[model samples]
Target: MKKTNILKNGALGALVLSVTFGCASTQQEEPAAAPAAKKDTACQAELAAAEAARKKAASVGGEWRDTGKILKSAKKALAAGDVAECIKLANKARRQGEMGYAQALEQRDNDVNSYTVERGDNLWNISGKDSIYGDPYQWPLIYKANRSQIKDADLIYPGQDLSIDRAVTSAAVNAAVQHAKTRGAWALGVVEESDKAYLAR
Candidate 1:
């Protein structure tokens, strides 16, 4: 029995010593950290600036340059005596004109007459007195109006007593005397020269 108790005590002591030394000699390791995520933040900022510049360039090119080109073409056509072509260019230049190209276009065709043929009357005398006609070539319109009485568009003689009633009106009578006093036939309305008196009432 003494021998068996001595062996058991020796084994228990060995087991306790092994456990204590193992605990004291053990080392702790640090945990692994996750890698930081990669980002394209600079690329995102560059893309935003490029898009804004593209839009601004498009707006400037489409508005001013395009409109100015059309107006320039219209002025060229007018100088070339292509009245109809000039009018078309003017319409395209509409966006650029501050006061409106449209109003000026509307007035271009409106020619007003101030006198009708009379006995021994000719294009020279008629155009001479009328400022709107400016030249004898425009006499065709006057001749057209009096075609029935004049017999021919080109051949009009004096004392024919043709209708000046078209150009003559109470307003003209007033203007003739008024201008004599004013030194110029200003303050006269073009509508009064074309006199739609019957329509006015």
Candidate 2:
């Protein structure tokens, strides 16, 4: 009887000890859970920031692969003595590529001016306004096209009438004129296709 009682007391003590240790272990883990929750929140915040950055980057209208290819081909066409074909191909390239070429082309249409050279006439200043042409190197094209009126290509006087061919239609001219006026530049007349020949009015 005595031995049985002793064994029962030992077993009860062991059970009580086990319950105490279990409670202590749970208490210790509670603090660890707070840190884990904080890490999860930080990760969520980082993911949200990454998503926002991705959305912001997408808003920028960048160049497409096809645009580069088309522009290159159009340039090659021009270099190969095909200005008419090059212009057509360039227009097609800009249309096919969806990378804000319309706005650029619209700007190009509007900035046309029958500019008379003032006291200070330099290709740099003239070319600066014509971004589509990109450089003073394109001035030769304008000069060559208007050589009949220009006595000297390099020394255009103050009162020479330089007829700029902005586009090939009245509607195109109007669109260009409107676009230029919006940007505070004087809109010069555009070239139009007549029944017989190209005309400007």
Candidate 3:
């Protein structure tokens, strides 16, 4: 009778131990899965943000090579399950893309040619110079551009600053020349003279 009682107690203890270990194993697995899922979500969010920034930069003619490399590295880190490293690299790529876009905008606006004034630089000589209009007749165009600085069309001093407008078409040039000829003839009291006689001088 005693042996029977001992056997029953030993069986009950074994059953309780098995149940407790099973519950512990299940709890441990649940915690591990939850953390992994959370990590995946974080990584995906970072990757999406980085991609958006890169596309915006590209649309503005930004340099994307370095950003592209950083993004690739981020993807590699993500695949390796290095969620922290992946997020860091992705953020870095995003900043690079933004900077590249800004630089592109600045360069676009800075695409202009500039020149400084020098001694012996009159409107006529400045326009005729090879670096400028390459035609002395284009002086009227220069005068029209610098109207605020030059009050007299006949006079321009050396060492003065001038802005050149290269958008002068041939038609505009001819019109300017005709206007100058008419004004000059009118000033000399020769409005009745032939156009050839007035322009010959």
Candidate 4:
């Protein structure tokens, strides 16, 4: 029994000694991180562009609520030498400004629902007007609305009255804009196949 106890105690002492020595050893120093790249003037042009776009949207009474606030933060970020954050905020502000301008144009005369065609007014030109849809490609909506009187989508008489659609859901509006963007080709007097496909949809 004395021999067994001595062996066990000897083994425990060896383990404790190994653990203490292992913990007492000095650790290696970690490698230092590389310095960040300098970008002093990188976001200057972007900051100018964002400010201009925000002003343009405000001129049209369409400035979004957060656009100015974001631009201010972007300017602060630039002053702080955070080039990436400044550029990102500037880009977001510019896009909001553009969208706000479009919204203001689309809502220009929501009270009036119909347009009397002028001598030089075609579906494309009319739809492109700020008081109308603000996008020429959205002429299809006008065409669809007045199909009972319009035979050729390209031909419209001066005195014809055309109706504007404002009650469409966001999905339908997006679909119309998408179709206008992707339609293949067009002709003057005849209806386009792409138009037909869009109308069918």
Between candidates 1 and 4, the one scoring higher on lDDT is 4
lDDT of 2: 0.49
Instruction: Please give each candidate's TM-score.
Output: 0.26, 0.33, 0.51, 0.46
- Which pairs clash in the backbone of model 1? 119-158, 119-159, 119-160, 120-157, 120-158, 120-159, 121-158
- Candidate 4: Cα lDDT at 193: 82
Say which candidate scores most in TM-score: 3
lDDT of 3 at 193: 38
| Cα lDDT tens digits for candidate 2, 1-201 | 999999999999999999999999999989987865674454444334433333232232223436556556656765675555556656555444433444444655666656666667743355445542444434433444465765334456666666555442424433333433342221223221220131122
Go through the candidates in order and give the C-alpha RMSD of each one to the true structure: 26.0, 18.5, 15.6, 11.6
Best-first order by TM-score: 3, 4, 2, 1
Report the CA-based lDDT of candidate 3 relative to the real structure. Answer: 0.70
lDDT at position 38, candidate 1: 15
Candidate 4, residue 111: Cα displacement in angstroms equals: 4.3
| Least accurate 10 contiguous residues by lDDT in model 4 | 26-35
Alpha-carbon local distance difference test for all models: 0.44, 0.49, 0.70, 0.78
Ranked candidates, highest lDDT first:
4, 3, 2, 1
User: Which one wins by lDDT: 2 or 3?
Assistant: 3
Residue 198 in model 2: lDDT: 17
Q: lDDT tens string, model 3, 1-201?
A: 999999999999999999999999998889888877898788888888888888776765564778888889999998999989998998898888788778756654563333456775666677677666556766766767776776655556666777776544446666556654555432222233333342333
